[model samples]
Target: MTTMTAPAQRFREFRMPDVGEGLTEAEILKWYVAVGDTVTDGQVICEVETAKAAVELPIPYDGVVSEIRFGEGTTVDVGTPIIVVDAGGDGAAGSADSGGSAGSAGVAASEPPAVQTPAPEAPPAEPKRQAVLVGYGVAPSATTRRPRKQAAPDVPAPDVPTADVPTAAVPAQAAELNGHDRAAAVDRPLAKPPVRKLAKELGIDLATVVPTGPNGVVTREDIRAAAAPPAALPPVTAAPEPLAATAGARETRIPIKGVRKATAQAMVTSAFTAPHVTEFVTFDITRTMKLVQELKEDRAFTGVRVGPLLLVAKALLVALKRHPEANAAWDEAAQEIVHKSYVNLGIAAATPRGLIVPNIKDAHDKTLPELAAALGELVATARDGKTSPAAMQGGTVTITNVGVFGVDTGTPILNPGESAILAFGAIKLQPWVHKGKVKPRQVTTLALSFDHRLVDGELGSRVLADVAAILEQPKRLLTWG
Candidate 1:
């Protein structure tokens, strides 16, 4: 008698990658493909936003999509499987015959199929090296699974029963009180890992909360609701309103994650850690403004954006050349000051995601036209939300043009790990003393905030003075530069 064998199933899982360096989690922005869709190698499957930037992830292999483990807007930990693909193969069919002869084949078909038994256990041993993208490669041994809690063993009932309770009905009574079976009460709650973490943080017992999700699962909203106080209670001493209130609310709460959350944390750290000393200078910038107009019409600046900000950036670079000590970072851990030879000039851009500071690497080496091109590209990329994380790292100094918003002058905070930040104010035709006369001339304010620990008052003053002097007389850019 001949026994027929089924085709073996081959599935490959793709985990959420650490797109940025050492990022632990990322939120799934959107999914480009769904289940039952055929996918090829290096096809973009989804977009995810980390703390740094939003990056698109591509599938590394060719297969038919079998499952999407996480939906959009779900933040997943690194190395956790997010999708599964069916890589068609029949290798297990051959392994089925290796174990048995024709005589035992009849017994195998009648009993639980022995070949397919180990299929569930085979995934742990499979190498994970092939499950990586081109640039972001996860280590083979980096995949970690949270340990599951074991169910408590059953205990014997007491011989004597109380008047209120009976030994036979103990399990049912416990199940009714907890809204679940006695066995399930001992097991872990039916919630996702993130929800469980939130419940733990909010000090809410998952068992006590009612499950409103499908299949009796507890959701994030359920945890929030459980943590909120009951509305029936009297308002004793005007308590603050809840963050997650009922519908038709007076306030809207945006979840703090991704770029906004990261920026908040970094700003807080910078504010308390750095000793900021801001110095301001209001001067007649008519010469520099005229130079901007001249550069716009210049053939050398063809196809490039020539503006006041470009000259301001160039002036700052020139100032750094004179005062190199200002372009340094305080290394707290090492207890030393790192004086950088090259300047990675950071330009603060406000994108839809949040405020990001992507710097031009080796800005001191670039010429005037090249600096303008870089600034234009940086602003355009930031507006389109395509700035990379690497472009934001290693900034020696920063410039924030608050002038674009038509704001006069405000002391700006230094970017984290940098020594100084310059705020360029709005350039307007104000009455100013130019050439020994009070005349309506183009005037602007410049505020320079520096870390006092590394840059003393003398050095900060000199750097600010140099930038103002260059803008006041554009000829100094050729002379001093």
Candidate 2:
């Protein structure tokens, strides 16, 4: 019998698009669809964790999922084909058509070749348009690949064994080791720059630390675990107590990934690169405290968090308006000072993931109530680990309310690319001279740290003084604004 067969089916492949600004890779956190499931264009098919934040990737086309190339928890590089789908027709329809055509053609035409139907090819894959992700734009074209650097010519290998060779001779290795004297731990353990810094800060040797991350990379948690003190020292009279059960079991290794890793790198860069100059001022903020209490009782602030931090943030914004130089960054490469006209006020939130500073866009334009609402939302999102990386960038100034932790004050480090960070200390009812009378007043300490290159002592002091003045007189916002 002669048979006519349905045409070969065409499948569309969806490659992993860059989810963040120039992020090369992302770990597939979860997949929302399975093989055989139908998906529409602009529907989120999977969630990926990039170095900056967790992001969801939407599928580009209407189709039945034919294959999943990667599993959850797998790290995928950008431009790699991640999924395949049959866009033209269902498999069952194709199969049924093929069978019917084959049987009919075989019976009808024995002499002539059976007529074959050509399956319509799926249209050229279009770049999936994604929703606005923070810090990432909609990929112009999803199908395009990043241009790769040209390969260097191969050189003949040295005749000696290089395994034991100390990497200290290499300048890059020296820089990574944190100094010229230390040798690179290339042969021992692999860790990211932030993890290496954490290890260095904790005085832990990565060579001795156990790696628990993918591909045997030492994580921050591993460094912390290694730095953890033994449960108890062995008694002098006793044989070293067989390793205590609590030694390793008691410690928790939380991998330094995502937000925490990014924060660490930024902090290190800010601390070392900028010449920081901190100035402190202890002030009486009774009026601001009173205003906070009044706001909480107001119907407008119902269900919203009203606290001293709100006033502190507002005060900082006002101060920035008065001393614009305080809201600037030193551009070393450009050798120019970038004085921001508008303030993207950043609020430092200590979230479960780590400390993240998500800024309120254009805090200078936001009213007190709007600023309060933005602050509350920013904190809530941060605590939920849902703050997008976009919310964390473009900060002109930052306020860290360490006062919530009951600390008096701290020399807060400047956030990278920003000139100043204001540290708000705890407000306590202390005896203070109010109108030349010693009485119990709401007092707090403020510490302002700035990049000395862009902000001089006079300018930093003026900004701190202005914030203190605003806090001292809550009515100044109405007049200054």
Candidate 3:
């Protein structure tokens, strides 16, 4: 008798993808799904905060969730699988391609009335990963944390229709479709999360207001308009109501935890342990802009991104050569200052949650193209929330580009363990004396902060002045480098 037994169901756990900028772990700020929730591939399942951004993580495999390892407010190190989904019987869920994106187009045939069926004999296949993580371990465990009691075993109810609604209204929909519960609330009017938060803060009821959007979703402008209900009259009243008055009275406190907590502890330890000194330099960066433009058009940098920051990074590396002390770090315990020949350039990026500094390893030796690519990748990785823990570490020096936000200059605090950190300010077109004549030229400011105990003002000023000099005269960079 050849009665074939069905093969046991097999599953693969998708570890958290390196969101960018050498992050070891992320805090699960919001969950978009619950246990037993059926999700589709590429569907956003949760919101996580990395050093640079709050990114919505997508599910790579289409299936019902079986477990969730970390809860909201937990900053887990990299390689931890936070969520588990039943990705059908045979569809493989694993590492994504090198770009750090999970691109598993789950088997299409597995959808519909037919369930996913796993092949009895299969080989383990690892995904091609993209970005790197920092501080976190290199290898991730294959097994998931543990199984959870997702809401419940969804009752396999037969397809039935509600009274008055047509058969097509149900849509053969999966039990755990997203937004199903919120559809009623969203149907009347809609807005982005930030917009909704704004409306809530402003004491405006979204439903009462007339929405001016394609799908009636309220935009930022719409919220602003609603805040000013009348063209002439101010939205807020002179007399305070009890709700509005008491809203602020109740002190809402957020526990110092996760990124905020960790950042605080690190900063305290850094500030108290290191004797700090900060200095600033204002300069005309017109030459740097012109050079950046030329580099962008050059064939050597065909695919590379050319920006003012690249020049600053290069100038810093060159300065490090002349002043190796600034490139080295103070090891108080060892009573020795280790001077490194290689430079790992760190860039501090402002994320939605807070600040993160991811570094470029051996950046001192990279060519213009290589530096451009590294800078581009570093910023994008931090912005994308995928930086690795290892990449974030071993930084000899750091550069924080506050200039992008329109600030002229700032005295940046040194990254812990490093001797020096530089801040690149915004470059703006301003009237300047060039060749003894007032001319409209691009201008910017730079700030350098160092450990005074290790880096004296003379050394710090020299390092900064050298960087400023190269930027002031673009040709000097060629001669200096």
Candidate 4:
């Protein structure tokens, strides 16, 4: 009797998705799984640092991992297959389970229940795949790198008269290679593309440099060391002296790829694209400060964050409602102003990665305590670098509390698509006239920067004035909101 063999398991590849936004590439920061590990659908497989932020990528299918196409620290382009999994759809495992049940039924009459049956003829198949949710299935494309160009063939030089040849030339070549072609051919060391370019610019030959990198690859330091003074070279005559060890800077260059790169590009685009006009106002926030303290004692704010920032955010939303034009975005391609009805209030939080402006969704709809809770969660998530891309998108307005750093205030740049940004300055006790009497009051400065194309000076001034009024009065929020 012939036993049937099971069909082969099918593998599915997972390609890198854009995460969010149209970011083209990301560097694999860490891998959470290895070959042969069982992974479920929606499990985080790896963390990648993109031009925007560090994001954790979730595998969309359930199966045993088969391969990791790229190692950690490798930058992979969007749509590239980074992992493979065995998603067995064919009834390989089911067939083995049927055979095992049959074998168990035949042996139960004579043997003990604990006795083991004979193993199946084939290996267990991988788990079946589930529906992917985060990103699409693996893209069909080749994963090979482009081939390097071939060096041109060397041409044999025409014979020269031995009588006229210099003796020094012939001896130098023999000495350099020890009269062996193999020694000459093995002189060139391996290096990454960037290191090779650096070596070329510094006039250092890789052939002479020693390798210090993994697998005998030459590094930037190796090139610099090869170019350094030989310890025996005599001092040079009065031209610009070579940069000595003391003069040479020991610099550490961090790649500008992730958050820093994204922030820089966004700031540059916003600064140049929008004609920014900043208006500052110094006001007494003593009433706002007193309200924050009173709210902290109230049961409504129990275990919830109550602070000046929470009040500032609420005031901004109220001001936006008053001056709707200031809370709009410019659609350059459509040549129209997009006025948003809802507020996605963004609060700028400084993180290890960089500045990320994550917003509270529908913040205008939330009560003061609810807004405080949302703000607290947003700040905590941002600090932990757990803020999702969706949370950072579609901000109608932003508040950057520069006061935390003791900064007076700054001409804050608008977020790429948003029309306005409010910079809240440090609050300090200063002598001020209140009801015609000079008394010490809590004073702070507010700088509002807005796009002139969407919000005119009058509209911007109204929004700023409204926010200042609410802070100074503390009771205007009830009337305005």
- True-structure Cα RMSD, model 4: 14.0
Candidates' C-alpha lDDT: 0.79, 0.73, 0.68, 0.77
Per-residue CA lDDT of model 1 for 1-481, tens digit only, reads 6554543446767778877766667899999999999998789999888898888888866789988989998988776678877876434446455655454455556766564443433334323345444234453242223211111124323322322222222332432333344444435456766678889999999989887865466877789878878782334223335635556767554778899988998899999999999999999999888888899999989999999999999999999999999999999999999999999999999988899999999999999999999999999988987788888899999999999999999989888899999999998998987779999999899999999999999999999999999999989999999
Off by more than 4 A, model 3: 1-26, 29-252
lDDT tens digits by residue: candidate 2, 240-282: 3333434655434344566678789888999999999999999
Estimated TM-score for each candidate: 0.73, 0.66, 0.57, 0.69
| Error of model 1, residue 168, in angstroms | 35
> What lDDT score is found at residue 436 in candidate 3?
98
Query: What is candidate 3's CA lDDT for residue 227?
Result: 75
List the RMSD of every prediction in angstroms: 9.0, 12.3, 15.7, 14.0
Give, for candidate 1, the lowest lDDT window spanning 10 residues: 144-153
Q: Which candidate is the best by TM-score?
A: 1
The better candidate by TM-score, 1 or 2, is 1
Cand. 1 Cα-lDDT: 0.79
Task: Report backbone clashes per prediction.
Answer: 0, 1, 27, 0
Question: What's the distance in Å from true for residue 464, model 2?
Answer: 0.4
What's the candidate order when arranged by decreasing TM-score? 1, 4, 2, 3
Q: Which is superior by TM-score, 2 or 3?
A: 2
**Candidate 2 — what's its lDDT?**
0.73
